[model samples]
Target: MPLVSPDNSATSSDEIMRYPFDTMRTVAATILSNVSIALSEHEIAWKKAQDYVQSLPDPLQPAFMDVLNKHQQRIRDSYKWQEDFAGALFNAIDTVSNTDSNISTSFQKIDNAKFTGFGHGHLIVADE
Candidate 1:
């Protein structure tokens, strides 16, 4: 069997196998873009949640804050774990090749930034 390029250039089977890398990048970028938009929406929702929590009656505020604190801490812990896991994955992938390593670097930066941003609940309304 032989592999042929559109330009009538002979291509290696390995090159053909690696062609999907570009496709994977395109797919990943599109997915990440969508996720980024969703994250923005998540931030809005968190702000609303914080506002609602803050609007509670003075006596109820303590209870509400307690619940929110517990849940938020759990969420942050889970995200921290996931961030570590993702960092490990990125490190493993980094060993693959130096070619287009920038792509991996970009992903690592985005992953860390997003994880840390969300983990800190930076979108939530500030307490007075």
Candidate 2:
């Protein structure tokens, strides 16, 4: 099956195909934004936890600090994964968008050529 039909109905079909990608891109961007906010909150909480551990007596602080450090590392790792995921999602969106644009442009050129004889010596004019 062709990516787009010669008729203009393909315009709507193109839009239909583009909808999901656009929606996914929007959702991914929103999720990434929320993740950033959550990461900031995590930093604040981690700092608070560290402060609380430091308030403990010197003998009690070391163990609590160690635990906090381990948990912070885990949180950082999780955030890194999320950042990587967002990067991947954005890349995919960009690739799809470029492909979609190229397809649309090609289809438009084909449509124009139908009326202009594809730049051959013979020209076909369309009736308005």
Candidate 3:
């Protein structure tokens, strides 16, 4: 997992001011795409396994089918679980993106302002 902090130190105003929303979105999308590809590959492999089980000798076919059926059930359950998880994750990403956009807009306004501050004068008091 990658640490999500700013790439530059806090002292670097330019870099610190920039948000990595795009990078985060890309990473999340890439992960989801990979999961999709993996699910597709799993389906293909399962189909092959079914074919193999069908070709097994008569006495062994029943046992293989039972095992395959159980395995498929587990895959189905996992798919459902991940589907819900991905949905929630995507929603969270969207929420974060929206919030980040709002914050960045406000930051830009502050960044664009021209102002200066200083202590005009100082008075000293002595203790007796």
Q: What is the C-alpha RMSD of each candidate to the true structure, in Å?
A: 21.4, 7.9, 10.2
For residues 1-128, what per-residue lDDT tens digits would candidate 1 score against the true structure? 12234454455443432334444445555555655565567567767878997898889878987887777667656555655554554444444445457777966666555342233655332222
Minimal lDDT window, size 10, model 2: 1-10
Best by TM-score: 2
> What are the clashing pairs of model 2?
none
Q: Give the range of the ten consecutive residues with the poorest summed lDDT in model 1.
A: 12-21
Q: Give a tens-digit lDDT track for model 2, residues 1-128.
A: 11333455644644343336666677778878878998999989988988888888999999888887988899888888887887788888788878889999978876766373434665565544
Clashes of 2: 0
TM-score of each: 0.42, 0.63, 0.53
**Candidate order (TM-score):** 2, 3, 1
List lDDT for all candidates, in order: 0.57, 0.76, 0.71
- Higher-ranked by lDDT: 2 or 3: 2
Candidate 3, residues 32-68, lDDT tens digits: the string is 7766887898899999998998888999999988988
Model 3 residue runs over 4 Å out of place are: 1-19, 99-128
